[model samples]
Target: MLDEKLLSRALLDDDKENLMKRLLLVCVLGLTPLLISGCQSAYYSAMEKVGVHKRDILVDRVEDTRDAQDEAQEQFVNALEQFRSVVNFDGGDLEAAYNKLQKEYDRSEAAANEVREHIEKVEHVAQALFDEWEDELEQYTSQGLRRESARALADTKSRYKQLRASLTRAESRMQPVLSALLDNTLYLKHNLNARAIGSLKGEFAGIKADIDRLVIDMQRSIKESDQFIKAMQH
Candidate 1:
């Protein structure tokens, strides 16, 4: 009788532990979306605690986006050069040429992704800052001050719209370039022969045109970023 009683108690304790673990897992699953939604607010609150504000964060993210675009521009140029070299292959290891082109494609893709992330960050902070600014405008007791603030907000919004449009145009241009690079990479991977090189040479002109358009758009975006940054600082 005593042995049976002790066994029953141990089994109950084990069951309780398993139940607790299950409950914890359910809680984590339920909280995932809530945590994601609240993350930006939590970040802003924490930054405020350390004397940093949303405007400052916005400026920083814009700078990061600008830098990302610059790096992406260079990566795309390098990838174009690699593609050109492959198309003009003289006499060397086909595998080596393919490997170099693949590396360049990978680098260009990573740079494009970074630029996209930075742009998203900039948009997030800019929206938050504008929301807060609009909310605070209601607290102004003087009509003159309120009107001035409203005008300033409108001006900033106008400039931001231009900047956003430029960034979006540049970002959209990347997909064609990426698609061309990916198509070329896959083609070379399958056909590592002289005929493949000859076929790719025909594609080189189209790829070059796409890259040229992307570079022009990116340059315009970078210029817009500079202007926006200056406006914000002022």
Candidate 2:
């Protein structure tokens, strides 16, 4: 009636102001986490400079990695059991079976990711420790002490090589199991009928074989982790 154009312009301006405020808030919130992460990393770096050292960090990370791998092994076993159950599923609520499989798959995925992350953490600290040791060798004034330190570093590296190989092998074994899991999960998701049970039957043998292999690999990795931890403790 009166000044409709002026009223619309005012409303548009108000909306823009609110939108800008929201965007500003979102950016600040997002940056806060990144800022905190940077601060934590800086703190660790500072601690290392003060003689806390990456060797200590490596030991902690290795223990964490070992525990994570153990947990992952349990999770994968549970997922395999669930997979076996679905394949042997008789006439029952198809939805329930699908849900269980989905849950197990999600859990397995999370556990596997945790294991991989822990391994990366261990590797990061280990590399930093080794590099620092090598660099510090030149700073040694006494020839006898320098030689001793060099020998210790070489021995540690050799042991780490074996441990890393075992851990990596265990990590690599997860892919086949995960792939098998995804295949069955997707198949069930698409065909949520009784036939979905039958569809998974053909995959059981291969999955069983994969799980058996995974279990063995994980066991070997765990043993390696224990030995490495013992070596570090000594």
Candidate 3:
């Protein structure tokens, strides 16, 4: 009986251990998104400690920002096409058409947000790299090396200023597009008829112009991003 009791207790303990392991695994899985989202600064600092500095991060983030902008441009183009289609609707369930346009607007907004987030990441890393470079200049023992480093830092700052200006202009362009999209979506949500479509038509030209300007700005920003990344690589 004593031996049986011990055996039963051991099995119970084993089961409890397994249950705890499973619960821990479940907790980790549930927290995955939070872990991924938390503390970019910590991640950057940890990477820096391991020799992966901010310059490398800046290059990666610039590319990411460029890609995000490209995606946003594509999404906006798609939304524009959808808007055109809705404006041309002859005889369909106007509510359904409005719903489709609304979905496109939502998608465009999400893409624009992604572009902004990538740009912010690029800015964050670039600022860190520039600040670190500037601070390290005082630490240089050799005057000649210090002067050379300072020159490089100044040149990088100039190029970065240009790049950041382009990026910010592109970001600013997104607002008009989003506003137009929201206006059209909201108008259609309420109207859902020929009059609503006609009303949107009057605004289409303005929306198109805004999109065209946005595209141009995004293209310029992308070019600047490529140039900056190439410069950082060297």
Say which candidate scores most in lDDT: 1
TM-score of each: 0.84, 0.81, 0.82
Q: Which portions of model 1 show Cα errors greater than 4 Å? A: 1-37
TM-score of predicted model 2? Answer: 0.81
lDDT of 3 at 180: 87
Q: Which stretches of candidate 3 lie over 4 Å from their true place?
A: 1-41
**For residues 1-234, could you state the per-residue lDDT of candidate 3 as single tens digits?**
211222233334443455443433332233574663454455555444434567766776787889889999999999999999998899969898888899999999999998887777677678878888899998989999999999999999999999999999999999989998998899889887788888989988999999999999999999999998899889
The candidate with the higher TM-score, 2 or 3, is 3
lDDT of 2 by residue, 56-124 (tens): 667767777788888888998899888888888777787888899999999999989988877876786
lDDT (Cα, 0-100) at 48 in candidate 3 = 49
| Candidate 1 local distance difference test against the native | 0.83
User: How does model 3 fare in lDDT?
Assistant: 0.79
lDDT of 1 by residue, 1-234 (tens): 211222233334443455443433332233575563456665565445434577777777788889899999999999999999999999989999999999999999999999987888788888998999999999999999999999999999999999999999999999999999999999999999999999999999999999999999999999999999999999
Residue pair clashes in candidate 2: none
Tell me the lDDT of model 3 at 212.
92
The parts of candidate 2 lying over 4 Å away from their true place are 1-41, 49-51
